[model samples]
Target chain A: MLAKRIIPCLDVKDGKTVKGVQFVNFRDAGDPVELGKQYSELGADELVYLDITASHEGRKTFTELVQRIAAEVSIPFTVGGGIHELSDVERLLAAGADKVSINSSAIRRPELISEIAARFGVQECVCAIDARLEDDGQWRCYLNGGRIPTERTLFEWAHEAQERGAGEILFTSMNHDGSKQGFAIDALRRLHEELSIPVIASGGAGTKQHFLDVFQQAHVDAALAASVFHFNEIPMAELKQFLADEGVVVRQTCK
Target chain B: MVAIVKYNAGNIYSVFCACKRLGYEPVITDDPELLRSADKVIFPGVGEARAAMEYLNATGLADVIRSLKQPVLGICIGMQLMCRHSEEGDVDCLGIFDAPVERFRPTSAVDKVPQMGWNTVSANGASDKNCLFEGVADGAYVYYVHSYRVPVCADTIATTDYCGEYSAALHKGNFYATQFHPEKSGSVGEQILKNFLAL
Candidate 1:
């Protein structure tokens, strides 16, 4: 059986983990590579390093960080954020990333998805969508990290991305995030229904039950949480054991 | 030294890194001489069937690989290409194994086309002799991300149940192939690679 994936996402700025990863016992808390290795030991199914760096030198550092992680960590990982063109995609994948995620660049130029998928295959391209359920009851997609809203709605853009050859969709809900409530189940379910590719539920993960709700109710292929896993609020091994007891198929740490 | 077959496929860096992690010196090369003379050859790929076969034929790697006397391991599309044919591009692949690759038909809502993430691989009954699975538990979890599959055959040493029983890894003489990525499969994968290196 295909086990549902559990992913821990990290925010990287200048090749360092921006958010306070309070739970890590590693010597250097800001080093993304060390944190990633720690997560792998703790049984993370996959890892995503969202590079928020903008400067050219910072991008180079991110690439270097990717190589270090790939060489040291034994699991697969996806690099996202600041990926604009095919060259950027090529650089990261060449640097040993299993996959690359794109957001605002894909929305600005939809063809970027096709270009990456054509050269590197669909499995290598991850389309990340940041949207918010606003007034008037529409899920409006956002850009620039949920600061600016786009005219494209959630479902419409996701369908287009799938058509344009995105193998997976990482949907982050702005309204439900930081509420300590749960994943945006309704929107995630709709995305899975409307698209054939895998859907990764992000944002609003507070408890072990939240993870179970997303996988059981929304039927998403994977669920990603940042702060909870980082803060050790919900340990991965215990969570997987709980989900398994609840009849949810999760990849347990190998014996 | 280990030689990794390089073709038009995307980066084979992960495979190289995996070898290095195992304390082996590996090189990514398309040279026929290096691949033929290496202690072992790793055929890793991530691309379409037709294009990959085309590149192999163009570079004469198809013949070079078929003629290898040492153990050769194939990963993902590399495994599919080792079969007789593939439904991906209706292309005829190298006939190393008797198995044929077919596309996965989405039977249910949850059966995603690309069977991504981790899944279990169980050693077949007679697979006790195949050292590639040495020290590895039956029904071990490994990472997989592919759409096409090869049905269980005489050469299938291990099977994984996604929609149904499919050949997860096939062993025939000196050729070994895995449908999943051992390099990306963590410790279990490392053990499998160690077993392969022991050959």
Candidate 2:
């Protein structure tokens, strides 16, 4: 059985971890490599580094940081933000990222999925969909970090992303994001039922129960969070232990 | 010195880092002479089988890899290429393990193809005595990300069940391979690599 992953997302700006990181041991919140090392040591199944502003200069810094994180953190990690082309994926993979998450670029050019999957294996590409619940009772996809909304619905685009060659679908509900209410369980279950590939449920994880809820109720392959892990509200090792006690299959050993 | 085969593959850097963490600075090279004289050879890859094999054949590393007498370890696509043949691109492989690679044909939609994330691996056959496992537990969770799988055969030393039971690790003579990425498999993985290095 594949263990359900608990991933801590690091929001990178100018190559440093930003927003809601407070580890007493590490004084530097902006240092992604430091925070990432901490998380991996705590037994977080994986880490996701999302470069919010992936400018040309930022790309260089992010790549360098990826190399550092790759060396220090032995666990697998996924890099996202500013990944527009196959070359970008190649650079990051060459730098040592286990996978690359494509969001806005994939929304703009759906074929980019197949292009990267062709050049680098499909397992290397992760299609991240930031979806907002619309008034019409449908979930619409968003771009530019949820600033611009697209006509594509969550189910339609996610299914297409898989058909195009995405190995996993990372669904983040804008409504549930940062609300700390829990995962968008209903939407997560819907997406889980729709796609054959593994689905990673993101957004609105305040407590350990949130992880347990998604793993038990929605049956997501993985659960991701930022502030919950970064702010130390839910330490990865404790959260994983809590989930394991709840009978969720999680990696127990953390060094 | 340990030498890692450098070919048209991905994530060789992480392998280098893993070895470095274990206090061995592995030499990443495609030169057959360097590969043969090394204390150990690590055949690691994360790319398409046809392209990778083509590069090995073109660079003459294919012959070098097959002829290496030292302890050799292949990973992911590297392990697939060591098989007799692969259904992926209908390509022939190095034929070291005499196993065939088959694409994951999930019987139902609920069964995922790539089988990504951590899964438990158990010792199989006489390979339970294989030193590669060493201090690793019987059902240690190792990282896996692959769509193609090698069916259970006589050479299979370790097995993991995803859509079905498949060879997670194979050993024959001095050659050993694993479908999982020990470099990215956390502490259990580090110990496995340490065990391999000690061999």
Candidate 3:
């Protein structure tokens, strides 16, 4: 059986891994390469590096960090944030990043996704949608780390993203992020119901049981977290064991 | 030298990347002369079967691959195309492995397609401590992404379950393959590639 994935996300700024409380008041964590190496050895299924400073720096530091980390770890890693054009995709690929994720830049230039997918293939392009529920009980897509709202609905953009050749959809619920309550099962369920591509559920992981809930109830392909993993709330090996205990299939470390 | 038969596949770079990690630079080519002369051959793909077969037939590499005497390893679609037939394209395959590839049915309550992510592999009884699975335990997880699977057969060297049991890896004589993407599967994946290189 295909086991569900557990991914640890790292926010990269100027080639360093950083974390913040709900995407603000950032603090340095450690070297990107070193942290990635640690997580890889700890049985992290895959790693996601978001360039939080891409829009401000006018260049992506995540690309260089990906090169550094790729040299250290053998697993596949995805680089996102500030990816604006086809050349950016090319640069990330050349830097050894296995996949390129697009968010704000993707909304600003929708054709960028199609162009990159056409050139590099859909498997290499992951569309990261940061969404939040509106007062009307509808999910609206947000960009720029969930600060900017787009007119498109979450499902609409997701369908468009898939049609434009996105291999996977990385969805993070802004309302649930860092709350440690649980994943937004409704949002994940909606995406899983609508899209054919692999859906990676991100944001709001409070406990090992939360992973089981997401996998069992929502049927997501993967679950990604930052604070919980960074603070050592859940060790990858132990979590895998917990999931296994719960009858959720997971990858065990080679003994 | 090892030659990775390059058609229009998605995971080609990762295989070349894996070979590099294993300390050997494999030539990614479809050239007949280069492929025929290489010490080992790696056939890899990540796309629809019909298009892949079309590329193979168009390039004349199909004939070249069938006649090769050296060991050949296939990955994902590469493995599926080596079987007797595939429902994916309704086309005849390389017939190296006596099996058929079928698309996964949407019967699971899970609602997930492609069966993406990592899963464990149990060595088949016929496996003889082969190098390809060295450092990989019977249930160690490997990365996979596909909607179709190869059914159980005599050549099955390993098996995995998704919806139901399916061949995760296979070997017969000089031919071998894995439905999983070893190149993207972390250290365990690297070890599999290393084992293949050592063989």
Best by DockQ: 2
**Real A-B contacts recovered, model 3:** 0.50
Question: Model 3: which residue pairs collide?
Answer: A1-B161, A1-B162
Q: Looking at model 1 chain B, which ten-residue stretch has the lowest summed lDDT?
A: B122-131
lDDT tens digits, residue span A33-138, model 1: 8899888988999999999988999999999999999998999999998899999998999899999999999999999999998888888989999999989999
Error of 3 at B5 (Å): 3.2
Q: Give the CAPRI class of candidate 2.
A: high
Clashes of each: 0, 0, 2
Best by TM-score: 1
**Residue-by-residue lDDT tens digits, candidate 2, A1-255:** 789999889889998777968787786778888888788888888999999874689889989999998888889999999988888998999999999999999999999999988888889999999999999999999999899999899999999999999999999999999999999999999888888889999999999998999989899999999988888988888898899999988888845
Q: TM-score (0 to 1) of chain B, per candidate? A: 0.97, 0.97, 0.95
Could you give me the TM-score of model 1 versus the true structure? 0.98
TM-scores of the candidates are 0.98, 0.97, 0.86
Question: What local lDDT score does residue B1 receive in model 3, on the 0 to 100 scale?
Answer: 98
**After superposition, which runs of candidate 1 have C-alpha atoms over 4 Å from their true positions?**
B127-129
Per-residue lDDT of model 2, residues B1-199, tens digit only: 9999999889899999999989998999988899999999999989999888888888899899999999999999989999999998898999999989999888776677788999998873453567888888888999999999999998988898888899999999999999999999989999889988888
Error of 2 at A69 (Å): 0.9
